[model samples]
Target chain A: MLPDPQAGGQTGSLEHIALLRPLSAEQRAAVARQCRWRRFASDEQIIDHWADTQDVAFIVEGRVRVLSHSAGGREISFTDIDAGELVGEMSALDGRPRSASVVALGEGALLAFLPARPFRDLVSGHPELGLAVMLRLCDKLRGATDRIMDLSTLGANNRVHAELLRLARRGRRQGAAAIIAPIPVHSDIAARVSTTRETVARVMSDLTRDGLLQRRADALVVCDLQELERLVAEVRGAP
Target chain B: MLPDPQAGGQTGSLEHIALLRPLSAEQRAAVARQCRWRRFASDEQIIDHWADTQDVAFIVEGRVRVLSHSAGGREISFTDIDAGELVGEMSALDGRPRSASVVALGEGALLAFLPARPFRDLVSGHPELGLAVMLRLCDKLRGATDRIMDLSTLGANNRVHAELLRLARRGRRQGAAAIIAPIPVHSDIAARVSTTRETVARVMSDLTRDGLLQRRADALVVCDLQELERLVAEVRGAP
Candidate 1:
C-alpha cells in the first residue's frame, strides 16, 4: 500500500535536511517552495515497490524502513533511513520503477517530496548536494556489499551473530560493554539477516548461555563485546 | 594481489569514457589530460579489497570481475564491469578503503585513471557527469538489491537457474532458444551465486537432463526462456 501522491500534508522548508544543509538559507527556501510535504502514521506505507511515481522524498522527521516482498510473501528488509536522510532517488535518477517499498517506523513520519525533474535540477545546481548524494549512495552500496558477503558466505547462525554485532556496534557503549536498549524484535532481525525467528531465538539463547550476552528488562546487554566480535570475526575470516 | 597505484600505466584522456561522454570535446580533452592510464593483462589484479589507494579507474576496453575472498580463501564474485564502466569510486568518493578486489578478465584491460580530487572536481563541476555517476550508482544498488533478494530467499538450484536466466537475457536470442556463447564457467557462476561448484555442476546436469538447457562446443543454449523464468518465479513467490 502507498499513500496518495497529492493527498497528504503541505509543503515545508528544506532548512533541516542534511542533504540540503550546505545550501544557504535563501537557497533552501527557494527549493522548499517547489516541494510538497506529507505526514504518515506508524506502520504507514510511504512508497510501494514498482510504483510508477518517481518523486524523491526527504525524511524531515521520524525513521522509515526500506524493504521488498518476494513472491512467497516473505519480506526482505534492506536498510532504514532516519530523519534528515532521503529516499526514492534511485527511481528519480534512473527513471526506473521503484526499487523497494518504504514504510514508516516508530512514530509517524514527515517527508518533503520533490518531483524527479526538480530533484535532479537541485542536485545538479548544487555541488554540495550532488556530492552529498554520491556519498550517501556510497554508504548504502558498502552496506549492501557487506550484507551480500554475509548471505553468500555465512550460515544462518553466523548471520544472526553478525547482525547482533552490527546492532551492538550502533548501541550505546557502557563501561566495557554495549547496551542495546529496547532489544530488537526477533522477527525484525530475522527479516534483516534472512533467517527464521526461531533461529534468532536459538542464537540469542546460545549467546546468553556462553556469557557473551545478558538480557534485561528493556535492553539486551553485550556482556563481552570483544568476545562477540571475535565470534563474528572467526566466521568472516581475516577481513 | 593488488597492483601498486603508481606502478601501472601512464596518464591518458577522459575522451570516450561513458561518464564523461556528455562533456564537450574540449572538456573531455581538458579532463583527460589530468588522468593516468594503464593496461592490465588477463588475470592481473587491478585493485584489492581494503586497498589504500583512492583513484577512480575507467575501463576503456575488456571486462573485469569485482569480488572478494573469505578468510578461508573462498572467492565471492560481486559483479562484472565491462568496457566503459568505472570502479574504485566507493573509496574515492567516501575516502575509505576499497570495498572489493577487481581483476581483469579476458585478454586484458585498458583503463584510464583519475586521481580522487580531479575526479571529484570533474563530477561536481559538471552536472551531467554528476547525474551520470548517480545513475551508475543506482544501477549498482539495484543489482545488489536483486542479488540480496536471491541470496536471502532462493536455494542453490534456483539461484543457479536465476543466474542462467540473467545470462540468457544478456545473450543472443535464436527464435525459441537463447544461446550463451562459450558458456560460462561453472566455478564462476558458483562464486556469483554463493554455492559450491559441485552443486552448480549437479544443477547444470539436472537442467540438461530436463531438456531445459543444451550444452555445445562453444555455447550453452537455454531451450525455453519463458520456462526458466517461470521456474525462477515459482520459487521467488509472487512479486
Candidate 2:
C-alpha cells in the first residue's frame, strides 16, 4: 500500500499556506529548498520559552499545544495550533522573548522553519506577504482580546459554559447535539478559564442534570449552544 | 501661544510618527493629501463597532479608550490608546467588523485617517513599512498576551497589585515610591482587571492598612515597585 501523502512525510510546501500565495512558483520552490522541516511525535517538546529561536516555523501537519508554567507549578495552555498556520513568529518579528513552550499533540506532525534573514527578505521582496502577515497577526490580537474579555467578564460556571460552546464547534453532530471528540478533562477547562477543576465539574454536573450538556463515549456533547450562550449572558447580570 | 501646534490644531505630519520613517518625503506628502485628520472633544465617540471603517486612524494627541458593551450592558474598557499610535487598523486590515468603539478621553484629541487603497499601496510599495507595521502589531499582540496571563493566573488582589506596578512607572518617584498622578478611579481599575469596584476598593483598603499602597490627592502612590513585584510573585508561590 502506498504511504499516505502527508502523513508527516515532509514539511508542508509553501503553496499549501495561503499566506504565501503572493510568491511566484519559483520563489516558493526556492523558499522550500531553504527551509528545514521535521516530524515530531506526540508529547514531544517543540520549543523552549527560555531560549530565543532564530528561525520561524509553520505547522505543516497535525496539531500542537502552546502552553506556559507559572512559578507555582501551575500549567496553562494558551491555544492549539493547527496545520497551515505560522507558529513562533512573534519573537522573531518583535525581538521579544518567546512567551510559551510548544508540544506536539500527535505523532506524524510536521513543522517547517525558515532562518530569520531570508524570511525578512521574502516579506520585503513580496509586499503582499507583509499584508498577509499583518492580517494574520491582527486576527491573533483579536482572538487574544476576546479571551481577555471572557476572563474579565464571565464568572466561573459561565466561563466553562462559554468554553464548552467553543469546543462544540469542533465535534461531530448527533441529533441536535455537538459531540466534541476526545473530551477535554476538567483540569484543561479550568486552566483555560482560570478557575478550579472542582468548580468546572460542579457546573457541568448541574448542566448535565438539566439536559443542557451530555457525555458520550470519549466525547462531550453540547445539546444546546444557543441556550448556553443565553445562559452565560443572563449570568452576567442575574445577581 | 502659536495656536498650540498639536492640540486641536493641525493633523500631524506623517514624518512625526516613527512608523512612517521608511517613506520618502515625496511619498509622505502624497499620502498625506490622501488622508484626513480632525480633533475630538472629551468623551466624544469616534467610531461605531457596528460599522466597518474604510480608513484607518492615528491618534495625534490626547488619550482614548477602546471598549465594548456586553449584552447585559456592562461596559468593558479593553485599554487606553495614547497619542502617536494607530487605531482602527485592525478592522480595515482584516476586513472584519469593528470589534470595539473608541472614544476620546480628553479635549483636543487629534486623529488622522488614511484611505484603505492608499494605505495598502503604502505598505506594499515599501516593504520596510510592512516590517514596521508587523513590529508594531507584534508589540500589541504581546501586550494583550500579558494581560491574558495576568487575568488567568492572578487573583483579584494580585491583579490589582500587578496593575499598580504597571501604572507606577508613569508617575514621579520619591525615595522608594512612584506616585501615579491622576490616580485611575476604582471603577477604571475594576474594568481593566475584570473585577468590580467594590473588590478593588476592598483590596486598596487592605493594601493601605498594610502601607503597601497609598492615595495622595487624586493620585495613587505605589510604594516600592520591587515589593509590589515580590508580592505578586509570592502569590504565585515563590518563596
Candidate 3:
C-alpha cells in the first residue's frame, strides 16, 4: 500500500512496527510481502471476541483498545495497543479462539494482518523476533498481575488514585507535576479499575479539594505524584 | 541430581517438564547440564517477592503457591503451580525482581533451577521451546484477563461462585458430579476471590442449604455440575 500523507505518512511498512524493528531490511521486506493491509475508522470493530480468526494485526497508525463486555452489558476495557505494536498473537500461538474484542480508537487506524501460520513461522524462524514477542508478553503479564493485585487488595478510592497515577505518567510532565490533557473519562477509568463512575468522581473531587490534584482548562494535573503513589502503597504493601 | 525414587520418582529430568518437552532429547540433555536442583520443605519460601535473583524454577515434584501479602498482613494467593510446570520465568525473561513469593505446598518440593542467562539462551535457541513458552504465557494472560473481567464486573458473592466453578472443574469427577476433596479453606478462598472468610462461609452454607453443594465425609461434592455452571454463567454471561 502506498503511504498516506494525510494519515500521518503511515506506509504500512514492517520497519515502523516495534515487533519487526529488529529484522534486517530484506527480512522485513519478506514479512511485509506476507502481510495484508487494512484501515479502520475510529470505534470500528477491528477484532471481535470469539470470532475464530487467527490473524495477528500490527498497528501501523492510531490506537486500538482490547476490551470485552460483561453479561450485564458493562464493558471491561483491558488495555490499549498503540502504533508499532501488535495484537491477536495469543490465538495465533495457541490455536485458541479470540479471547477479547479489539476496536480502533480515535480518527482512523491502519493495520497489517498476518495470518496465523505465517506469523508463527516468522516468529520461530527469527530468534530476535521470538525473544521480542516473549518480552512483550512478559510486559502484558506483569501489567495484568498488577491489576489483579489492585483489584484483590485495594479499595475503590485507592484504585482510582492508582489509575490517575498511571494516566499521569502517560501524560505531559510539567515542573514537578504531570498534566493529563483532556483528562480521561471517569467511567472509562471506573471500568479499568473496577470501580463505579460515582466513586471515581468522588475520588477526583476529594483529590482536587485536598490540593493533591488540580483542574485546569482542558487538563487535569497530578500535583504530587509521590503522595498519590504513597496513598496506594499504604494498602498495597511494599510492591 | 539422582532420581529421588521416594520423592515420587522425580529425576529432575527436562523430559518431564512441559515447557521443555517440545525440545529434542539431545537439546534437553544439553540444557539439563546447565541446570541446578533444589528442594524446599513444606511452607518454605522458594522465591521471595522483590528478590533480585533471576533463576527460573521448573517444578519437578510437589506444588507451590505464588502469593503476596498486603500491608494489612492479609495474604493474596495468586495461583498454584503444580509439578511438570515452571515458575520464576518472568524475572528470568525481563531481568526484573521476583514479582511474587512462591512457597512449597506439601511435605517437600523439588525444583530444577536454570539461571537467567542459560534459560534465555535455551528459549531463544530452540524454536519449539520458545513457542511452548509463548503458549504457556498466552494461557496465563488469558487467565489474568478472565480474573480482571470477573473482578471488574462480578460482586463478591458472584466472584465466590465463579471461583467455585473453577475449583469444581479441577476437582475429581463422579459421573455428573464433581468432588473437591478436603475442600478448599474458606480463608484461602477469601484471599483468592478477594472476599472475606465470612463471605465465603456464608456462600458455602447457602449453596449447601440449597442442595447445590453437599458436604461429604472428606469432600465437598458439587451435586449438579450443570447447575453450578449455570449459576456462574447467569452473571458471567458466555465464555
Candidate 4:
C-alpha cells in the first residue's frame, strides 16, 4: 500500500519550473487556479499501476522515481524526476491505466496535479504548453531507447559501468570526482542495470578494490571519470 | 549501410493519412507543397542513426520497424509501425540525432516526409496537428514503458510468451490461432526477448512439441493462446 501525500512547507511555484517558466504571468495564474498542490513523503506512490485514474503531476520540489514492481516485491526503476520536471503525463496522454508506479524519492516531494481534461485544454490551446510537454516526452523516449539498447547489447558489468557513468553526469561533482548522494542500494543498482543484487555487489566490490569507485557514508564517488568511461566503452570496441 | 527508399506508385494521399485528415484543403495544400513522397524496400532504413538531420515521416502504406543496433552487429527492436503512423518526430522534437533506425518491414513502404522546421511550424501553430503528434508520441511512450517492464521483470520464457502474445494482438487472427506472418527468425525472436538464438530455438521446439504452437511455411502460429497467456500470466502473478 502507498502512503498518503503529506502537505506542508514552501514549494516551488509554477512560474519557476523549466516548462512553465516560458508562460506569461497571466497564463501561469490560469494554470495555477486549476491545479491542486500536494506533497508526498518519500517512497509514497504518486501513481500506481492498478489505478485507473491519473493526473498530470508536475514536480515542484524534491525528486520522484518511476518504477514497476514484480509480484515478489522486487522493482525495476526507469527514470527519476527532479524539481521542474513532470510525471504521470504518459497515462494522461495515452488514456491507459498507469503502466508503472511513481514514488517520491527523497524526504518528500511537492507536485501540482493538473487533471487531464483541463491539462489538455491548456496544452492544445497554448502552443508553448504543448511544445513543453512534447519536448520532455522526446527526452524520455530517447532515454528509454538508450536503456533498451544497453540492456539488450551490453554485458552485465558493462551495463553497470555504463549506468554509473550516466548517473555521474547528472550527479554532483567535487573537484574531478562525481558523487551520487545516498548511494543506491544493491537492488536499485540491480534494477537499473538489469542484473541481480549479487552480481551488482560483486561488480561494485571489484570496482572499489580497483580504486575506480569509493563509497562514502552516503554517496558513491567515482575517483576517476576517465577510467570509468574507459571501462564502460571497452566492450563496445572503443580504444 | 542502409538501403535507399524506392519511389513509385499512387501512395496514400496526404489528405487520406490519419494525421492530415483534419487539415483544411488549403492547409493540406500548404502541407502537400512542403511534403515529399518516398517508398522504401524491405529492410531499407527510413531513418539512419548516423544522420544529423531528420524530418517527420507519415506512413501512407506498409510497415516500418524501429530497432537499435550495437557496434558488434547485435540489435534490439522496439516496435513496428503500420500505415497512419508517424516516425522521426523525436529527433524533430528535441533536435537530437535519430537514436534508432527505422526499416521498411515488408515488400516496400510509402511515406510523406515533412522537413522538421515546417512540420514544427504546422504542429505548434495548429492544435489538431499538434494533438495528433502528441497522441502518437504518447503511444510510443507507453509502448516503451511496457517493453522496459517486460525486459526488466520477466524471465526469458515468460518474456518470450509475453512478446508472442503482443505480436499475436497485431497479427492476423484465424479461428483459435494467432498467426505472425513471415515468421520471425530465431535471432529476431532472441533479440526481442533478450535471449540468445539457441535459447529461442529451444523454446520454439518445446512449444511446438507441446501442441501450443505450430510452424507454417512463412508464419508462426499460436495454436493455444489461452495456454500461452496462462504461461505468461503465472510468472507475472496474475489471477
Identify the superior model by DockQ, candidate 3 or candidate 4: 3
Better of 2 and 4 by TM-score: 4
TM-score of each: 0.94, 0.88, 0.94, 0.89
Residues B1-239 of candidate 2: C-alpha lDDT, one tens digit per residue: 11233455443566655667677888776776676777688988877767757678777677889887665666778778887777787776777878778889966477778877777777778888889888878888888887877877788888888777778867788988888889788888887787778988999899899898888888888877778878877865433
lDDT of 4 by residue, B48-145 (tens): 87778778888877899888767687777777788877888888777888978889987778777889898888889888778878888878777777
In model 3 chain B, where is the ten-residue run with the lowest total lDDT?
A: B2-11
Q: What are the lDDT figures for the candidates, one per model?
A: 0.87, 0.77, 0.87, 0.79
How many residue pairs clash in each candidate at the backbone level? 8, 0, 0, 0
Pairs of colliding residues, candidate 4: none
- Candidate 1 steric clashes: 8
Candidate 1 clash pair list: A71-B237, A71-B238, A72-B237, B10-B37, B11-B36, B13-B32, B14-B32, B182-B218
In the range B55-147, model 1's lDDT, one tens digit per residue, is 998887889999998777889999999887889887888899888999999988877778899889888998888988888888898888989
Q: Supply candidate 4's per-residue lDDT for B183.
A: 88
Give native contacts recovered, as a fraction, per prediction: 0.84, 0.74, 0.81, 0.62
Q: All candidates: CA RMSD in angstroms? A: 3.5, 4.0, 3.1, 4.1
Clashing pairs in 3: none
The lDDT of model 1 is 0.87
Q: Interface RMSDs of all predictions?
A: 1.2, 3.2, 1.0, 2.1
Ranking by DockQ: 3, 1, 4, 2
DockQ of 4: 0.57
Worst 10 residues of 1 chain A by lDDT: A1-10
Could you tell which candidate, 2 or 3, scores higher by DockQ? 3
The best candidate in terms of TM-score: 1
lDDT tens digits by residue: candidate 1, A1-239: 22433575445666668888888899887777677778889999999886788999888888999998877777889988998889989888888999889999998798888899988998899887899999988989999999999998899999999999999999999977999978999989999998888999999999899888999999999987888899999999855
